[model samples]
Every structure is written in C-alpha cells, then in structure tokens.
Target: METRHLTYPDTPDAYPSVMVLGFFDGVHKGHQAVISHAKRVAAEHNLPVTVVTFDPHPKQVLSNKPDAVRYITPLSRKLKRIEALGVERCLVLTFTKELAGLSPQQFVDDYLIGAGAVHVTAGFDYSYGKFGEGTMETLPYHARDQFTTSIVTEQTRRGEKVSSTRIRKLLAEGQVDEAHELLGAPYVICGEVIHGDARGRTIGFPTANVLMDASYVMPRLGVYATRVKLQDGRTFYAMTNVGRRPTFYETGAVSVESHLFDFSEDLYGQVIEIEWIQFIRNERAFDGLDALVAQLKQDEVSARSILS
Candidate 1:
C-alpha cells in the first residue's frame, strides 16, 4: 500500500477515487464496516481505494485540559491495519493548529477535493473541521454538487456498538476477550525489546523487555496469556507481565516483560509484537523473588493451558 503525508497544498493524482475517512483508532468492527463499504464502492466504480485519517486525533488538539484519553493506535499501526484491509493507498493527514482552523467546507475542499475522490465513505457519527463544525448530517449537502457520499451505519456485536472507544474501555477494564471480539482480532502491542535489569536471567527465565508505543492503549496491569511475534514474524506462546518489579522493590515506571515459553534466545534490540490472548491475574506486589518466580510458574501453566 502507498502512504502519503497529505497537506493542504498537496493534491492527489488525477483519478476517480473512493476514500475512507476517520480517526480509525482501533480499526474495530465499525471502522471495518466503513472501509468494507468503501472498498465495495471503489470496486463498483472501478476507482482506486484511498483511506484518509488524521494524526494526533482531533481530541488531542481540541482538548482544553490535559486529561483527555490517550490514543489506541499510533499512526504507524493505524496505517498498517488499514492497509491490511486491502486499501490501495493510505493518506495520513498531519493535523495542526492551522489545519484545524479551517471550516468544514474548507476542509472538504482542501483535503477531500484535493484527493480527487468522487466517493467518500465514513461512519454515521464522523465529524470534521474547526471544532467539529461539520458533521455527517451536514457533509452530504455540502458535497451535493461535488461528490458522492456514503455514511456507514454502526456495527454491533453482542448488542453493543463496536467502536475504538468501546474496545479501549474494555481493555482498560480488563475485558480483553470482549475487546478482541469487537476488534475482530486479538489486541497486540508492537515495540522494541530494550534491555532491562537482567533479573529474569538470574532466575533462569530470561525475558525480553518491550517498551511499548505510547500511542497504543495498554491493557489493565496484569499477567496475561500472550502470543509473541518476532521481527522475523515467528510467533510463540508466552506469558507477559505489565507492572513494576514489586518483588525487587522497584517502583517507578511500569514495564511489559514477556517470557517466551520453552524458547531461549538473545532478543536485545529486537522488535517484538505481543498479542494478548487472555488475562490471568491482576498485578500485585509479591513478597520475594521466590514468591514471584513461583507465581510466574503458575502463570505459565495457566497460560499454556488456555492457549493450547
């Protein structure tokens, strides 16, 4: 898939295109429905499929206070997942103060028009430009003479709306299985394996320490059954922890560490992707190293049983 950093001045090449527009935080089932519709439209019209999304989510820029929720996916991961949907091109618009100041009409004229898109597909609740001045209700009329528009309806699973926000809420509440069902896949965090204190090595279970991308929503602190994917794309059953090293009296930043079951290798500096499958237990401050190690053994047993 081709990716572009779209700006006001840059226009798409001259071609009939169908575009999918939204923040697409988790690319959950709802977002997928929008993309799926866009793809079908593109196929019927014989136009290239393009996906347009903004960076730093509009919420981040529009927040008056500092406590707005963090993002669920970084631009890289967002684009990767969207591309996996078989879109031909992904245009990542860098949202800035200047860009946000444009009126809804100005935004459509500048970005959507610039993309040469004749058909645009988005969710029913999608809004854009200058304090959300443009909503789905207002967009089709604004584009009446310009292009075709389709507002995809909400997608629901188990009677609940499938959405990035809903998935994040589930993850934060430690309902990973429910989140996965909404996401249509397991929740995975990809990051580089950084060096830690090497304490796991001393305990005979050397682990790879992963520093996760801040943009990705982390699940509730706990030990989880996970599938670890290496840079080479090999996957393995694993047990992962998300917490401070309480047994060693360490108290600062929470870390994610994974012990790949029955695997031994030097993984320093490697990028590892962890697919969280199931939650095991909440993080706790164990009494000593032996206690922690003993609990980890139990965790591995539970993880293996669950995964197998």
Candidate 2:
C-alpha cells in the first residue's frame, strides 16, 4: 500500500477514494469492521480503499498529560495492519496544534473533500475537528452533499464493545489471550535485542533483552508464554519476562527478556518480534539465583505445555 504523510493545506493527488477514518491504534476488530465497510463501499463505487489515520495520536497533542498516552499498535505496526486489510493507500496526518484548531467544516473540506474521498466510513463514535464537535451524525452536515458517509455501529464480542481501550486494559491486566481474540491476532511487540547485564546466562536461561518502542502499551509485568520471530523469519516458542529484576536488584528498570527454546545464537542488536500468548505468572523476587533458575525451568515446562 502507498503511504502519504500530510499536513494542513497539503493533500495527495486527487483520486476517487472510499476512506475509512480512525486513529486505529490497534486496528482492533471494531476498527476492522469500519474498514471492511469502507472496502465494500469502495468495491461498489469502483474506487480505491483508503485509510485516514493520524500520527502522534491526537491525544498526545491535545492532552494535558501527553506522555501518559500509549498505543496498542504504534504507527508503523498500525500501517502494516491497514495494508494487510487490503487498503490501497494510507494517508497519515501529522497531528499538530494548528491542525487541531480546524473547524468541523474545515476538516471535512480539507481532509475528506480535498483528498477526493467520494465516500467515508468510520465508527459510530468517531469525532473530528476542534473540540471534537464533528460526529458521525454531523458529518453529512459538514460534507454538504459532496460525498457519502457510513457509520459502522459499535462492534461487540461477548456482549461488550470491541475497542482499543478494552484491548489495552486487557493487556495491562495480562489477559493476552482475551486481547488476541479482540485483536483478531496475538498481541505483538517489536523491538531490537540489546545487551543486558548477562544475568540470565548465569542463571542457565540465556535471554535476549529487547528494547521495545515506548509508545506501545506493555503487558502487565509477568512471565509469559510467547512466540519470538527473528528478522530472518525464524520463529521459536519462548518464555518471556516483562519486569524489573527484583531477585538480583532491589530496584531496576523494567525489561523484556525472552529465552527461546532450544536456541543458541547471538541476537545482540537484531530486530525481533514477540507474540504474547499467555501470562504464565507474576514477576517476583526469588530467594537466590538457584531459585530463579528452578522457577524458570517450571515456566519453560508450563509454556511448552500451553504451546503444545
């Protein structure tokens, strides 16, 4: 899919497009339904399916506590998911204070109309423009008959709405398996393996320390069953820990460390992806290195049983 980064008064070459609009942090199931609706409309109108997403998340720009904002799938991963959904193009608007000041009519004219969007689709609750004054109910009033609009109703699973917020909550609670069901895939973290203190090796469980994007939401601090994929496409069943080293240090920075089963290779500086499968146990301080090793052995057995 083609990607275009735009700011106000800058638009891509005009082409007939059926656009799906959302922040789409995780591109979770509800967001997928909106995109799917756009695709259907695009097919009917013989236009390309396009997605309109914002970067730096609007909240990061508008919130009083911007640093508190986290993402389920940061821009890079979100775009990948959009492309995998058969979107032909993705137009990412860089959120700024200036753009945030656009009036409802101005946003409709610049982003939807100016971009040649013949039809637009979004979730029922999606809002736009200064102070979020534009709603799906108000979109047509802003469109002025220039384009069509579709508002996908809230998608539900197990009698609850499927949403990015819900998925993030699940991740924060270490409910990865449930999050996966809502996401239509396992929750994944992409990062590069970095050098650590080499403590895992001394404990008989050599680990690849991962430095993940801080913008992405982290699962609850725990040991988890995971699948690790290397840059070269090799995948391995693994056990992963997301926590500070309480056993070795009284206070330390949180880390993501994965011990791949039957794997022995130098992964320093290598990019890798980890898929969270299940929460094995909460992170805790062990009595000593031997106790840590014994617990890790139990974790490996549990992970293997679950993966099997």
Candidate 3:
C-alpha cells in the first residue's frame, strides 16, 4: 500500500479516486464498513482506493486533557489495519493547529478536491475542518459536479453500535468478551518486551514483560487469556496480566506480563503483541510468593481452557 504524508502544497496527479475519511482510530467495524464501501466504489470506477486520516487525533488537540483520552489504535497500528483492508493508498495528514482551523468549504476544496477525490465515503457522523463545521450537509455544494458522497450507516453488533468509544469503554471496564464482539476480533496490546524482576521465573512460570504504549487504552486490571505474537512472527497461546503486581505489593506502575504456554525463549527487547480474549480474574495481593505462584498456575489453567 502507498503511504503519503500529504498537504495542500502537494496535490495528487489523479483527480477522481474514491476517498474515505475518518479518524479511524481503531479501524473498527464501523470504520471498516466505510472503507469497504469506498473500496468497492473505487473498484467499480477503476480508481485507486484512498483513505484520508489525521494524526495527533483532533480530540487530542481540542479536548481538555490531551493526554487522558488514550486511543485504541495509534497511528502505526491504524495504518497497518487500513493497509490490511487492501486500500491502495493512505494519506496521513499532520493535524496541525492551522489545519484544524480551516473552514468546511476550504477543507473540501483544498484537501479533499486537491487530493483528487472524485467520490467520498464517510460514517454517518463523520465531520471535518474547524469546529467540525463540515458535515454530510456541505459536501455537494463544495464538490459541485466533481464529487459524489456516500455516508455509510452505523455498524452494529449484538444490538449496539460498533464504535471505538464503546470498545474503549469495554476495555476500561475489563469487559473483554463483550469488547471482542464489538471489535470483531480480540482486543490486543502490542509493545516491546522488557526485563522485569524475573519474579515469575523464580516462581516457575517465566513471563515476558511488556511495556505498553502510554497513549493506548489498556484493559482493566486483571488476568486474561491471550495470544502473543513475537517480533520474529511466532504466535503463542499465553496468559497475560494487565495490572500492577499487587501480589508483590507493587503499586501505581501497571504492567503487561505474559507466560507463553508450552513455550520459552529469550524475549527481552523483542516486540510482542498480546490479544486479550477473556478476563480470568482481578488482580489481588497474594499472601506470599508461593501463593502468587499457585494463583498463576490456576490462571494458566483457566486461560488454557478458554483458549482451547
């Protein structure tokens, strides 16, 4: 897939490709549906499928706490998901202060049209430009005879709108099972494995310690059934904990540590991805090392059962 960091200065040579625009934070089912429609439309028109997304999400810029609302999928992961949908090109625009101030019509003329969009696809609630002034209401006037717009309806699963916000709430509350259903896949956290105290190793179950990206929302404090992917691309069934080491009296610093079932290898510094499948138990303070080890063994059993 072609990745372009586009701006008004450099416009596309082509003038009629299908475009899908959104924050696409998780590229969740709803976002995917819009992209799917755009891809199909693009295919029919024999045009390249392009997705326009912005970095440093608008919420981060406009909200009170720029740091508090942790995103589900960061830019790198978002791009990867978009590419997986077979999008021909991805335009990742830097969401600068000036860019955010553009009027609705200016955004359409200078960005959408300049980017060569002959057709556009967006979610029912998608909006653009300064103060979110651009809506489905404004597309026709600006594009004139050159553009066609399709608003993909909301996607639902189990009677709820499949949305990034809902998924984030589910993860925050540790509702892994429900979250997975909305996400249309397991909820995953990917990061680099780092050296910990090796306390789990001393106990019997060796674990790969992962340092999660601070900008991403984490699942609730609990043990979860998970699948871990190594940097070398090996995947393993694993039991993961997303919590402070309460059993060891550690607090404040939350961690993600996983014990790969039936496997062992040196993993320090390697990037690992763990998908949370089911919440097994809440984090607790064990009486001692032996007690902690015993509980972990039980966690392993529960995780294995769920995964199997």
Model 1 agreement with the true structure over 257-304: per-residue lDDT tens digits: 999998988888999899989999998888878888898889989999
Candidate 3 CA-lDDT value: 0.85
Write model 3 residue lDDT over 1-308, tens digit each, in one string.
88888654455555468999899987888888899899889989899888889888777877788888688888898888899989988888888777888888888877788777889889988888788888876777777667888888889887889899999999988898888777667877789989999988878889998988998889999899999988878899999988888777666788888999989789988988888899998988989888887888888889999999
TM-score per candidate: 0.94, 0.98, 0.96
Show model 3 residue runs off by greater than 4 Å.
7-15
- Candidate 1 deviant stretches above 4 angstroms: 9-11, 64-69
Q: Weakest 10 consecutive residues, lDDT, candidate 2?
A: 7-16
TM-score, predicted candidate 2 vs. hidden true structure: 0.98
Worst 10 residues of 1 by lDDT: 7-16
**How much lDDT does each candidate structure score?**
0.85, 0.92, 0.85
Which tens-of-lDDT digit does each residue in 57-157 have in candidate 2?
88788889999998989898999999999999999999999888999999988888988989988999999999999999999999899898989998999
- Winner on TM-score (1 vs 3): 3
Residue-pair clashes per candidate, as listed?
0, 0, 0
Q: What lDDT score goes with residue 78 in model 1?
A: 79
**Candidate 1 vs candidate 2, lDDT winner:** 2
